[model samples]
Target: MGADGTPTVMVVDDHPIWRDAVARDLAEDGFNVVATADGVASARRRAAVVHPDVVLMDMRLPDGDGAQATAEVLAVSPSSKILVLSASDERDDVLEAVKAGATGYLVKSASKQELDDAVRATAEGRAVFTPGLAGLVLGEYRRIAKGPDATSAPSLTERETEILRYVAKGLTAKQIAARLSLSHRTVENHVQATFRKLQVANRVELARYAIEHGLDE
Candidate 1:
């Protein structure tokens, strides 16, 4: 963590100017800018040492692909959350990164404030997406769930189901709690239970499942 008890972060991008600017902005916002790397190898090497709370990764690196780097970094430090910062908004790229265990995806066109907030959200285990990509991902999940070989769906309580819908809509636990007239801790508990029932790791996967089953409607 940083001096102010803020989370630690690493910026990994092939472009020097962009990397430096992001690092500077995050550092100014009270994050501990632990390390900066320009490619996959360096990112993996440095990440093992620092184990930052959040890693801002570019999808295209000079030495290797960013999704592969995200997997490698997580292999070395499973607690670290990776947020893909890429120029591409292609559906395949986003899905590939998500499959590789990225906590979020953001495009290069995102504003500085958006990027900064995404890092913070990633560290807190929330799923972030660039604008319209969340719906694309949800649509893919829906298609898969509707396939002939789809298995029987997991059972969720009515409360859990409602919360899942809120999650699919990208509402945070606190926000959901506020809207539902429940305590934040109660909402978090429901979320964790929902995750276990669905066997998903984070909000993104849970949201995908909910959307796939038409619970988000």
Candidate 2:
């Protein structure tokens, strides 16, 4: 636990072997780890008990989708981070997970070192995605926004949108400030403004939101 909380991690995947393996990996990294090979409800119950710093789950489970589990976890523990884990990097899975509040996404192909870094980043409220996963998430958001039931995006100011474009290009706040001839504090404030308006936590979410709404243009 850093100042925020203990790095307790909950694993929710149906495969017993995989679940145990992930739990072992996290434990080896000194994380307080809990794992369940059950459904979403069981995972939620375990999460409530452990109140983990992060939850790593498979997108598909026996009883329900990990998206619902993510919502439940965030509802119960708003500060907790969620990371989707599975073999599916499908656009729909990626978007659904992000929209449901997951801060990270990883496929089974990830090495132990990569998985460790991803979880650590997520626990710090950062977003992580494998190669090409970011674009997949953005595409799904585009599809959602184009659907009939789509809601209007939060209104953004010119500065906020400009800041968002830089974010979409993967520039850090300091880097963005340098490029835009603004103070670092000013750039950070703009980033925070975007976060609040989009109701997301980190740069990856902000970038995905920006790209989805055509703010990059």
Best by lDDT: 1
Per-model tally of clashing residue pairs: 0, 0
Query: Considering only N, C-alpha and C atoms within 3 Å, which residue pairs clash in candidate 2?
Result: none
> Per-residue lDDT of 1-217 in model 2, one digit per residue for the tens?
4444648788888888878888997888887785554668888777776677888978888888887788887777777888888665354555556667776578878899988977887777665644334444344444444655346444457776676566656676567789889996686566444434434422234333322344343
Number of the top candidate by TM-score? 1
TM-scores for all candidates: the values are 0.71, 0.68
lDDT of 2 at 106: 80
Per-candidate RMSD, Å:
5.2, 5.9
Model 1 per-residue lDDT tens digits across residues 1-217: 6666699999999999989998998888778899999998999999999999999988888888886898889889899988888765454555566667776678888887888888887778766654234444444444545655345434457787676567667777678889999997687566545434433332233333222344355
lDDT, each prediction: 0.71, 0.66
Instruction: Candidate 1: list runs displaced more than 4 Å.
Output: 152-217
Query: In candidate 1, residue 61 scores what lDDT?
Result: 86
